[model samples]
Target: MEHTQKLIHKIINLTPLSTAYEHTPKGKRQLECYVKNTCGITAKHLARIYRVRQARQLIKANPQLSLAQLALECGFSDQSHLNNEFNAILQIPPAKYKKLIQQ
Candidate 1:
């Protein structure tokens, strides 16, 4: 249990959108298993969530921030990628969210 907590802490501290497992004979599988078993989510999902969370924070903090810049800043591949992921996670695209914030 203690080991699990420690591992979770390590995994949680990893940078956003970085789900690369360590290079070892079984490192990737073991890390994937640990992430799934402990977090109840896949590593890719976790990374995606992290990126969206960052984008949300940026949007809220800087209402003037552009979606294109936000996408690049938050590690999204492009504006469309950001839109897709943002909509998936928050159920609202960044542009709409910005508009709502403006009103």
Candidate 2:
């Protein structure tokens, strides 16, 4: 279990989740199983979560940044994309989150 958590952290921290995976010699099926067992989510989903976390960090660093700029910086397609992610993951939109953080 310790090794499993270490592997997950390596994938999550060392690189963006999009390119973090390397399928083993066994095959794609094994890779899929490994991903599911390691983190219970797909790589694409992990990448989205990572992007939102990155956005949040950037927001904290520069509270004056615009949502459009934050989205672009964090690799979201647009402001709405960032907004959707913030709402889905955080249950609050980026604008409101920013406002609360500033207080």
Alpha carbon lDDT of each predicted model? 0.75, 0.73
Query: What TM-score against the true fold does each predicted structure earn?
Result: 0.79, 0.74
Off by over 4 Å in 2: 1-29
lDDT of 1 by residue, 1-99 (tens): 444444455444544423344322345566667778878998678778887888888888998988999999988889999999999999998899998
Candidate 2: lDDT of 96?
Answer: 93
User: What TM-score should be assigned to candidate 2?
Assistant: 0.74
Model 1 Cα displacement at 33 (Å)?
0.7
Cα displacement (Å) at residue 88, model 2:
0.2
Which 10 successive residues of model 2 have the least lDDT summed?
A: 18-27
Residue 79 shift from truth in candidate 2, angstroms: 0.7
C-alpha lDDT of candidate 1 relative to the true structure: 0.75
lDDT (Cα, tens digit) per residue for candidate 2, span 27-101: 445555676777788745666788788888888899999999999888878999999997898788999989999
Candidate 1 has its poorest 10 consecutive residues by lDDT at 16-25
